[model samples]
Target: MAYDSIEDLLNNGGLKPGDVVSQRELMEKTGATLGAVREAIPRLEAEGLLITLPKRGLMVPSLDITFVRDAYQMRTMIEMTSVPFAIKHISKSVIAGWIDWHNSAIDHLDRGDEEVAQRLQRLDWDIHLQMVSAIGNALITNVYRVTSIKTRMVGQSRIRVTPANASRVIGEHLAFLNPLYAGDEVEATKALCQHIDNSLTLALGGTL
Candidate 1:
């Protein structure tokens, strides 16, 4: 939190697909001590944000098509099924907050920096999870919180945030929201399905 590992990557768009980074480089850039860098690496590694080589230094994890597929499979299962429960329990204010976060991500869609856009997309997903938590279903929310990191690890690879993809994602968010706003559980579930399926497809080819 103190250092600028993720923030640096987001701010300057320094990280890229298949880019490898060593402790020395991280230290130089982040101005973090070796211990701090060491501690941070594992956290990122756990999130699939970092990868290690046998004799090589730490690098960005490679994306795999299988990982993408499976991650989406799990995500779709969790999110789609959670829709009815979320619709029942989530509050209007929470839904509004999600919409605002989704719109903020859309505003950055044309930033021309793919990495920054991807970071925003990831943050948007984070906000969505928070919204889901408002459903007050501890079991479902806990499962989602655990699986989401895996999904992020794989999904982050394919999120390029072009106008088209950004628009599509934003639209899906609306699709999920409209029904929720109307208190229509069925429509909300349908929208959730489309969103999860589309996310999986997008990530399948672009991982790593």
Candidate 2:
């Protein structure tokens, strides 16, 4: 596979942040040949996903202050700017589906369904991305995609699952949904910003 594909593979659950990885291990795990692994490494390195160090060839970089800061900042920018267009373009059915999924996630979390509750975290991501896409700006959508990938990588690599954090995450998403469904763009924007801020605080190793 190519580096872009490799990046997707890793993002799809192949590699974890801060994990020390080797060429051979990557080749085997990803089913890519040595050549493909070599090609992908440099690109991954450029993306801040990989870190080169003395005596330790390469490592999946840990979620550091820079990545965390940048991720939250870019995310906020995309979410806030996309709101006006999203309010205009996103169909009611799509909004309803998002609402249904989010409500299910809340129910699952309340019932202590760890597996579904954990997977529910992704709903927050999907809702925001869908909103951005509703704006119909290919340029902005694609740019936000890179931010999405980076954010996903950091969360997957570093964030941990805990009851308090999970509850807070659920609450944050729920906070955004009300204003969105009400078609109150201003309040929706505020909720989205608060959600990102909360996420930034949580990314500090879940201290929040």
Candidate 3:
């Protein structure tokens, strides 16, 4: 419960990168007991979500060029490694379902349905999680989970998915999903690489 509250804060922009927060502040914001907050600290630190200072409060990771690069690189490595396994193991029906969701999401975003847009964001993460989980390695999945949280933090802090760019975002997802659904490993890999590169470019504010 405490972990969930922390994640909620992170996702909702209540907690941002480089924010130093005390335990009592965390307890108040998350509505978790003092003991619960303390217990969750070690796990949060272990996952790279929090850093303990000598005397100051816990600090969220700062968003820097290096941090963004490393986070995305780790994401690319883990996700690319899972592509082959995902291609072989993931069902065509599941891929089709995702494709359908993306298509619908594009329409909803066009109509300015922010609720659908939010759901689309969750779906985007789910697609990646499903792909990675297909690798069947608990350790890799666990590592990916941490990497994903960091990547998400960077994205949330740096990128804003407005209606103008929402379609492009969904389109990027389809770039790989289409090929994967068709069972074309080479095309899927190429498209996935391009998509990640595009995402990184956007995350860097189009500088890189």
TM-score of each: 0.68, 0.74, 0.89
Candidate whose TM-score is highest: 3
- Model 1 error, position 131 (Å): 4.1
**Between candidates 2 and 3, the TM-score winner:** 3
lDDT of 2 at 90: 83
- Residue pairs in clash, model 2: none
lDDT of 1 by residue, 1-208 (tens): 5244654463334564467778878877777787888888776667456677767787765556676677667767767666766776777777777677667766566655466456656655665576567667787776666455545555554554555466676777788787887788888888778776766666666331
The lDDT values for all models are: 0.66, 0.71, 0.83
Kindly report which residue stretches of model 1 are placed more than 4 angstroms away from their true locations once superposed.
2-4, 7-17, 29-31, 46-48, 100-123, 131-158, 206-208
Candidate 3 per-residue lDDT, tens place, 13-105, comes to 788889999999999999999999999999999988999998999999876778879878988888888888998999999999999888877
Superposition error at 203 for model 3 (Å):
1.5
Q: 173, model 2: CA deviation in Å?
A: 1.5
lDDT of candidate 2 over 53-86, digit per residue (tens): 6676668766667876887887788789988887
